[model samples]
Target: MNRFNIVYYTDPLCCWSWAFESTLRQLREYLKDDCEIRYCMGGMLASWNTYQDTLLMVTRPAQMGPVWMQVRQVTGAKLNERIWHFDPPASSYPACIAVKCMGRQSKNAEEEYLYRLRKAVMLEEKNIAKPEVLLQLAEALDKEAPGLFDLPLFKQQLTDETTINAFKADLNERKERNISRFPSLWISTQEDERKSLLITGNRPFEALQTLIHQF
Candidate 1:
């Protein structure tokens, strides 16, 4: 049997990840049975409020508008650039915590919750960074599975550190381990030897499926 440790690192607020969601979905559809997956956070937006006046927040999505179009051209996923004008810059940490919270609740539910989050923001124009909204999401997720917001676990479970040490460590380790690209795949041996091949950003499902089979 061939087993792979596939690490997916991305930011919730990242527009590229939004474009890549279909690829991510396709990657899992083909690889989940054959691989052990790990989801890691790479902090893309540190803070949203501090940039209340700066162009960093104001201009990022403006920049993303054309990028979304390009990504749509390539990936064929739906993204509404109107969100940039309608919603404020999300901190992405709260959304990240929500993901961790869902994962802590159910590994299976994590991706579903993530999908909901992306849909809420990217499609419906909902603000997912708010506790009320997250709580609502939590309620929806919890109805399907219980104790998701049991707090101490979500608080204590690497959510804080994933940004601080865990995130930095993962970045440094990726460099040391020589894994490049956002959604890169690093195949690992039982002895923990690593060989990586870049999957690149948001390609067709068939391309990723071939990569999974090649391993």
Candidate 2:
């Protein structure tokens, strides 16, 4: 059987993607060694250049609180909306760059780091967009995962220009795919230019199973 390659386009700050975590984990476990999964960080909030007033950004929590409450009702995921009431992140680019830098350690490390970041934002309501918060996440993961991350090396990679560029490349790929939504999954073979399956928005495990079964 030929292995499938899956490109997951997501943003750390995206609640919809966070809600699909369970489904994604189940799909990965079911596929096991038969699939290759790559996570691409799509920049959710590039910047606030268009919005001049800081208050305009500050009021976002009000807008997001109700939305997250509805998401929790649907996905059954715990999300702390208080983070928005307090100090909200200005952009998701920093978190995206941090995840890209973590990839330098190992693929597993990158995935682990991304998972932690998402949990911090969605559950713990941590401001993962900050550099200090990101470094703290690295330390916590190092202690929790044990030998999964190299702190010194990870910090070094964080400052490397390539890491930032890699994140920008992901954003460009999102544009190329004409992806406007979070939690988009593109399944294809290495030998094929066409995608075998493309799923957009939050999806259930059954949707994934149905697509893979067709192959």
Query: Least lDDT summed over 10 consecutive residues: which range in candidate 1?
Result: 49-58
RMSD of each: 4.6, 3.3
Estimate TM-scores for all models.
0.73, 0.91
For candidate 2, write residues 25-130 as lDDT tens digits: 9998998898899889989777654322242232344566666777889889888877877877788889999999988778999999999999999899899889
Give the TM-score (vs. native) of candidate 1. Answer: 0.73
> Deviation in angstroms for 185 in model 1?
3.6
| lDDT digits (tens) for residues 1-215 of candidate 1 | 46667767765666667777767777667666767776665545547434332422243545555655665676677877676666755677677766765565566667777778877777777777776776676567667766544544554553455534545665566567564345555555333545555564556778766665665
Taken over the whole model, the C-alpha lDDT of each candidate is: 0.63, 0.84
Highest lDDT: which candidate?
2
Please identify model 1 stretches exceeding 4 Å from their true place: 48-59, 144-181, 189-192
